[model samples]
Target: MLYGLIICTITVIIMSTVNIGLEFGKLDTEVFLIILKSFPIILIIAMLLEVLVIGRIAEKLVHTFSDNTDGFNAKILFTIFFTVIGMSLIMTVIGGMLGKGISPDSFGSLSHWPRNFSIALFCELLIAQPPARFVMKKLHLRQEDKLDYDFD
Candidate 1:
């Protein structure tokens, strides 16, 4: 859950920055304001979608393919694989609808769905997961040392 929150925070900011800039043909001060308006809605939905839906799917899939011999890296990779693919597919369309409304013309954005998926996959791989993993590791270490933390 903590891991998902960190990843969502990073990915939402980066994805919103890029997508909003593409929409307006250039970045400007106004884009950040728009993001501020939209960010909480997007982030909450994304966190719920990941935790409630995609994360469960990924865990199941990982347990299916993984054996006792598989290392932590392999399991983590499997989780990343399924989760990112699932999140990318759903969020691309959801993002469009949330931002643009569901007109027939809005469905035209499906044409760019592949591009959106590619960007999301790369962003998760290159930008979000690394720092999220780092934070989780630190938290785990703190836990092992008998330190207590509470997100709630």
Candidate 2:
């Protein structure tokens, strides 16, 4: 639950900010307000989906791909790749639909989802996940079993 919450919060904030900027071409008070208002809705949905869906799938994938003998770097890379792929696909569809419903004029068509998904995946891998892991470690919020991997 803590993992889900942290990831969801970071992912939503970064993705929302970038999407809003892309849509509006500028960040203003009005846009900021819109992002703020939408944050809870997106965050809640993301958290639920992460906990119920993505997290389970990711755990299974990691278990299948990683053994106790696997190096920490290999495990981390596998986990991140699985997470980015799963979350990107799910969030792109959800975000695109919500964006269209919320402001049809601002969001482009579904055909643009590939680009959006790529950007989100890139941001998650490069920006959000590392910082989130650091924060979780500092706060002692990470589960020992889930995060622990043999560094050797």
Q: Model 2: per-residue lDDT, tens digit, 44-130?
A: 888877778876788799999899999988887787677767776777667777777656643545555676567767776777778
Q: Pick the candidate with the highest TM-score.
A: 1
**TM-score list, all predictions:** 0.86, 0.73
Q: How far is candidate 2 from the true structure (C-alpha RMSD, Å)?
A: 6.3
The best candidate by lDDT is: 1
TM-score of 2: 0.73
What local lDDT score does residue 80 receive in model 2, on the 0 to 100 scale?
Answer: 68
Model 1 lDDT per residue over 43-144, tens place: 998999999999999999999999989999999888888888888778777877877897766666677677776787788888899999899899889886
In model 1, where do residues sit more than 4 Å from their true spots?
Answer: 147-152
- Distance (Å) between predicted and true CA of 1, model 1? 1.9
| Candidate 2 pairs with clashing backbones | none
